[model samples]
Target: MGDLLTFKAGKVRYDETTKRATPLAGKGLVTVAHHEEDATFVSLVWERRGPGAVDSHDGSEETEREELLLFPGDAQWVHCKKCTTGRVFALKFKSSGDRLLFWLQEDNGQAEPGTLSAADNEISAVLNSLLNVLEENDGNDIVMEDKTGENTAALEDTLSTTNTGISIPILSITDALPISSFVAHIRSLPEQALKPYYDLMPETFEHTRENLIKVIQTPQFFSSVDTLSSVFRDSAGIGSLVASQLGYPYQGEGIEGFLNGARESGLRESENDRVAKDQEDVMEE
Candidate 1:
């Protein structure tokens, strides 16, 4: 619904399919948002301040002189290339004119927008490269967990199992092994534990079972799982969680270290607790 990634960048263009690029006159606010109706559609919107414009995008803002460029998130490459003048991102696509380019920078409290420090700029460059890996993907990454489709097919296969087969498919949400056994198993499970979905159903089972199946069957679910895992794996502070789980020495030291740990873990009480509680009688109102 909102911007997934955004930055200020000037639009660049190629001349007659040549490598040489011509940077547009002015830079603008570039916003990246997902397609509202489709999970797979990622797109970009660039709004540059200029002469009067025809319309706006995604329902926000009625304004004059707004130059806008939109690119549907289908691109062959979204990599940053260093040029003699400065860094320009080459957002290559099968079609032309979708290259969303930007001048990467940090904004000082009083300085102009996009005036980032060198360190921040370096980090931004690295992140754009990472985005390239995620957004540049063209493969069909959605795959159902098991080799089965449709719950009915699974149940039928289970019911038709024969004596020639040593074992039934044991039909998981993902399997099938028997006619009588499967029926008995269904009767046995007032609530199936790990059959269709491997989640430990909550007290809200009636509310969530169908929702869970719908989520699992979604076309982008599998690929999204992989992409999110990769992002979290490389995210800062995740290492701290992994270290804590594995019983390693605390990565941080002293008061600063103790306070900066993963907040998701139960809060630790110590001599250096940031805010100590008082007796009920003396507590502040």
Candidate 2:
């Protein structure tokens, strides 16, 4: 485990029932919730020491000018509004660099000294929020991709194949059909398939297969689950990977959940092998 970074952000009051906090949010701040009850929170409050210009986020120059706020303070407690969870503590940093490197410990609730990893989520969320704030301040805006039409078309194709009176489920074919054959099957699919290839082109299979091979070739392929998890933790095109196999309509949350399951399975396998080896050694004695 690496060093766990800690920051102190004063005190906080969390309502066990309402699951929300006060003061901090009203002060032009945004809060992100963690799943664990005792998971530490991290925040990077910024204050500009000099002059800077806020511009339109549309990849253009010139808009507005203002001082930049960089750091806020230490860690503080916050809660989720949707659940009756316990109060969550947060750490604060001054610079974006510090916040990026600030790792948090994720508690599994029943275990002590919880899981520790570099605060990847905290950094991504905070930086994105800050950029959004700057964009708003400069009268710029966030861009949202509209793939609804494409997604719907893709979904229809998958359902037509799956919800049919077939001898086998479509998911079963996913394993038996070779990548080329599967793609060709979809391509020859009638309009009922609704152009599923557009959402994800047929060429995606080649790339995904190559990457999977890379993962298998890694020296730590049979190492700890943590090591293997790290390999696919931020998979280059994880969204595409899921959409290709799951038949379009891919969500990042879904991919992450699947990855977590795979990690747990790997860890259990490793432990079982270790125990078996120990028993074999004892028998030899």
Candidate 3:
């Protein structure tokens, strides 16, 4: 939908192993279809589950019919509708729209501008507050935009009560997601579970493994390790509590070894060198 390009609905040839899809132009009308809000309208990867128009890439005029996997394209959002009032579409769905709820509920995944993902569910408190306000004004029909008028002498009824039609890029074939590789990748795997993929797709396996190690070696990961190390090497703050939770059997305070022989190798390094030096000087004095 970027830069106003016309997209003809098309068929695609998909490669399962490599996860690549090559689209063929279908020369059909494309619509945004209005993604529903009350339910997960789409899946991360899906098929329409019926015979669909497929484009025949051959030079001759021809086509095929079959199902194919669908993925969202580069653009994050679009606005279009199936019904036509001289090709009219609503920008924002009505508060009382019939299809606000969706029939299908799938785990919609895409952390983009328009796609609904896990992030939406994270704001329960805000939703609860909105629900309370809506409950208080149950009978009040507050339109987001009001165009009703009894006196239409100055302006015609069409002009007075017309809903302002907004402009948005129409969803088209070019906006579909590319399938050359996996749409998402895993940062971690089950213990030794990647061995099979290691033998099969060595490049992919190594790529994933290397990235996972890289993430672990990051500064954030080191900070987490520092927090974990304190549970055994120090008993300040909640360190002793965490150690006790880990079955360290510590009493009162301190992270000294209990019944378990588990302990950090060599001497416990001083976290605050200045404080340690002060303590040493005081002991000598």
* Candidate whose TM-score is highest: 1
Residue-wise C-alpha lDDT for candidate 2, range 181-269, written one tens digit per residue:
33345446465443433434233223333233222222232233333244344566664575557553444433354444445555777
lDDT of 1 by residue, 54-103 (tens): 22222333322222222333243333322323333444332221233344
In the range 34-138, model 3's lDDT, one tens digit per residue, is 223212121111223335443433344322322111122211111112111111111111121111101112234543322333533322223223222221212
**Comparing 1 and 3 on lDDT, the stronger one:** 1
Give candidate 3's whole-model lDDT.
0.28
Error of 1 at 28 (Å): 1.0
Candidate 3 matches the true fold with a TM-score of 0.17
Off by over 4 Å in 3: 1-207, 231-240, 247-285
TM-score of each: 0.30, 0.16, 0.17
Instruction: For candidate 3, list the clashing residue pairs, or say none.
Output: 10-26, 72-177, 73-175, 73-176, 73-177
Q: What is the lDDT of residue 45 in candidate 1?
A: 57
lDDT of 1: 0.38
Given candidate 2, what's the lDDT at residue 257? 45
Better of 1 and 2 by lDDT: 1
